[model samples]
Target: MSILATEIWENRFFNGQWAVAEKNYAVTEVATGDQLGVMGYAQPSDVEYSAQQAKVAQEKWWALSYQERAQIFENAIQVAIDHKADIIEWLIKESGSIVMKASFETDLAIQALKNAMILPSSVQGSVLPTQNGKLSLAKRLPLGVVGVISPFNFPLYLAIRAVAPALALGNAVVLKPDERTAVCSGFVIARIFELAGLPKGLLHVLPGGAEVGEALVNDPNIASIQFTGSTEVGRIIGAGAGRTLKKVSLELGGKNSLLILDDADIELASQNIAWGVFLHSGQICMTSGKILIHQSIFEKVKQRVVEKVQQLKMGNPMDPSVNIGPLINQRQCQRVEGLVQSAITAGAKLEVGGKANGVFFEPTVLSQVTQDNPIFEQEIFGPVAVLMPFATDEEAIALANMGDYGLSAGIITSNVSHGMQVAQSLKVGLLHINDQTVNDEILNPFGGFGASGNGTRIGGPANVDEFTQWQWMTIQAQAPNYPF
Candidate 1:
């Protein structure tokens, strides 16, 4: 049952005469344990170049104008868009995300590519407010051969989110995608870029898992690193980068929070609450982890939230009626189940959905949860929510900001003053008042604070700069201070 994707062949201008080496395809349905296609192995696959070789390639790349580099990346984005169906289908099969979610992933990737392209031209630096007549200007430039590490969830989106921008900024990219999701990334785009006529080594997909990742991180020629995954791994990689003084960008783990004040509209609150916790079966790093409700409306809102989460249709990714899909794999399912089981044994009541249903872990929302339970402090990456009661606006804010993983926080309230106060009070990078911190847009800066992430995602200007070096040049009019 191999799905054959027609690989486009460009005018192969790199090796003198025109040639053709079309990208092969393989589709493995991870959920069903079905291997649908043969693996496409390049003849010269997983080949490594010396530090000097990498530098030589990088120098040639960095010498190009930003506009030229941006155009090349733009072509690659077009190639991506043309094969949207293949990419989305493969994502659904490999990642076990609902088709709707996978479709959104593809669309978001398109916007991200557009966003990523802009960085090449917009990696600007501010001129320091100099009192003297000095030509002081700072500019951000590429960090040569950039290393990118991606996770299984949203593999294409996260990988290219960094790769597109890094490539546009005249940096060669060596991508190391998650092992389970590597083939999709490795062969999926290899043909696309080949079709787009991107020079070899400008963007290469390295296969394998942790060892491959470690190799990339340790590579001296690799000037920078971009990563998206667990907080523990992010810390280890960040530490590794520090030793070598390499630039690093990370979007790590999150135990997000959501607050519901007394005055919030019940229907709207419940609707948003459902999305807050259940989106992508709550596997998203920014999915609301702890949900605090005002005691005055706790009973009423808790019931509504429970009912809403229960009503959600959980099934196969291909089913249009499915609102939630399976976990990435069995291990994740067990980990999520373990957290809830511990909480239940410790006396937390399962108000609505707690039992595992099929590949889908029932949209589990546990009530009466407190810090006494392990799930309270842990990052249970599943479709679960804890409805804790709060007395005052200050208490709600306090409860919301209590966690160390401050990636995102949500609030549902009509009072502008309270909304602003909570928004200002939270320690998270993104605070959505009257809304859940989900459905991330491509134009916004997506990142975290505290232990969640090391900085920004691909949607913002900050992300592009994180992978670059800020160089300054100044010619002072009055240089009488001290000539070194």
Candidate 2:
């Protein structure tokens, strides 16, 4: 058993209070397989109870002025700032994130909260031209309660990515953080909001596995759903939300492409590509799975990338010098290993590290990956990347679009005009110029195209659209005459 496991898992956050669960499940560290602690296991009935409480709390919360709601979110920023070090430590232990990656996630979550605070001022409605003696206006209203399902890879940021905005928009929230990192995200996040003076029942954190997730999705009280995870799981959540006629926002999977045009600066391109593919071991939705290099620069770029991967330090994430960390679990490590082995069996050449020891996978690079290989077509959520040569600009774009997922894509070119043109042609919701695919901003619209997500975006002023409904109101002193 992990020493921290018993200490951390003694209680679970429920309806803004720390309490024991009906059952407990063990959480282990990925690198050493040591018990970190046991977290609460929420049953289906607990899901129903949470939804009912959220609905009740939302009525009172929604009645407050937008400025009032914004003030509460502003308080959250201070809470996050004050607890930064502790939260980062929890993230590293619970999610197997390196020191830098953990710090980045914690900072991003705080920034998102700040962005959420400002968004209420932007949630404005419009007045329509009147044909009759009537006052007409279209105003946005909260969707009542929101259900947030976040992944373990970015347990804190992904959860707050939706939760902060939903709260700002006057809706209550029921959050289901991934089972693996529930202690930090579930318990600690609830503490952050409570410390910020959010009303009880307005936000409920349920740290659970698939059963809890399924129950939350099926509950009638949840008005909308926001999910970030694998495309396979997103599909199920989307379908369930559809059946319920509930609004759904999905930030799903991605096989993002990093295009190295012939005119690109080799050194700069290699550096960005290395960061994009190896950051957090490439467990992010926007991580570049495919490195599409111009045929003229393929060998040069590949050599630099392989050299960069070789230099990356892979060990305990707690070490500031370690550039890479373990996968979320043994299963993920095995999956990544299996994919690398299968890719090699299908004739792909492994140029660098392709092995796993315990839960740690070495930074791996592959060449000669064919279209038929899964590694080329799917999201290999690991520190693994494949380099492929493209003969022409059209071929490069074609290769980038070959996959069904298109959350993010980027091009590196010295020519700004060419980069802009290619960026316009790409189908992803987010496009980068002279940068890698791994980029995000709190105030920018964040989502993807096709299998990557639904059309709804989750960040910036657009957040209001995902968590609220537009209702047009008209009032007339005298009833208007109909055609009759």
Candidate 3:
């Protein structure tokens, strides 16, 4: 039975209903390069319509009581839970996520939706102290209509990371999911909300390419924009949002680093870091592309990394045994190949795995990578890892911070105190002590610094702040005497 043969598999949802697109875009499976499904390519008019409908629905959605909003989210969570198997199937087929990755992401998405239930009750106004017996208070209000642009990687998790919060905070959402994972991210997401009783026009899902994304972003009715994708595209959205004076939040690119201190357990670091680099074939934004190892244990760590890479099984995502799956598309596979080749030309040693077959690229490891190498600077978002040695703690920190990206960084050390110290010195927004760079929790603020993104964080209680605005209210207990 094909996953896409069903009516709910490849369609657009708008105004609380589903419709097929006039033109169908064929979706290819990353592993086999076969037609997995066909998704509707939303037209510019459709995008505009989503925005207009969202605006019309925002008022009514906002008027709902917090309990009502929370109930909807609660129902939505149940819907996600009920459709878990289908979501996982679509994730594997469309996003090329291995079993563990698909399952983890599905659970994360469900948890995010469940955690968002806190928003309705947790969102509170602040009472400010005023002088001369004046009453001042500030209320956190929804941003009206939130425009969410999500990436193909971790489609369900990333989409709901924004959508759940925006809807929970009383704002209508217009979601533009990446075309590659339209089935899971677009249609399934809409179905979940629809079944959860989200009102008509309050939630819209349009899956298309760049034109559809641009239309959604440029829509004047969209009150704010939330995006997760490459840093280059994030820059454009940031600039456009700036010109329009619209509030925006971005979770962008990362060439994150993983540092192995001299006292680290090489075997454990290798075992854990392999998951970081190879999970989803390194498609995650926080996947560590660079590794800085202390010169003392550099050789041991490098050998262990090679061994770990060798252990990864790349094949169909549905197979429980496969650890690494295919990249999202052939272009990305080629880009990873090109980056690895460029590094090799620059004198970096390819320790293991550097070949690409169809959409599947071997999990590669490179050593002696210099700062001049493209892999050292550019984000090769594939199952490729680069290892470099540093003589001292300062040198390692310098190498880790010597990049345009500062999204996430990891410090692996036996000494907890030392790891904490190193973590504090790093420039990235999120740091993991004795863990991989690719770490996320629904209850924590997740985002990056510098070229990685604007400092605005998402998730946790911060999401409410990002998707809402502060409005001040004042009352005069007594009329003030003024000379007019």
- Write model 3 residue lDDT over 214-323, tens digit each, in one string: 77778889889999998999999998888777899988999999998999998888876787788788998888888888998888888888988887788988888998
lDDT of 1 by residue, 68-159 (tens): 77787688789888888888888877777788888888887778778767776773677776655767788777778888888877777777
Score residue 203 of candidate 1 by CA lDDT.
Answer: 70
Estimate the TM-score for candidate 1. Answer: 0.88
- Model 3 Cα shift for residue 479 (angstroms): 4.9
lDDT, model 3, position 99: 87
Instruction: Give the alpha-carbon lDDT of every model.
Output: 0.73, 0.87, 0.86
TM-score of every prediction relative to native: 0.88, 0.96, 0.96
> 1-484, model 2: which lDDT tens digit per residue?
2212355447554665665788877877767777766777777788899999999999999888878888898898998898888888888888999999899989999998988888777736889888777899999889998999889888888889899989888899999888888866767778788889999899998877788888888999999989988889999999988888888888888999999999999999999899999999999999988999998988999999999998999988988899999998878889999999999999999999999887889999999987888789878999998899999989888889887888899899999999888777788988999889999887788999999998779787678788899999998898868999
RMSD of 1: 4.5
Off by over 4 Å in 3: 1-5, 9-15, 131-133, 477-481
Which segments of model 2 are wrong by more than 4 Å? 1-9, 481-484
Using alpha carbons, what is the TM-score of model 2?
0.96
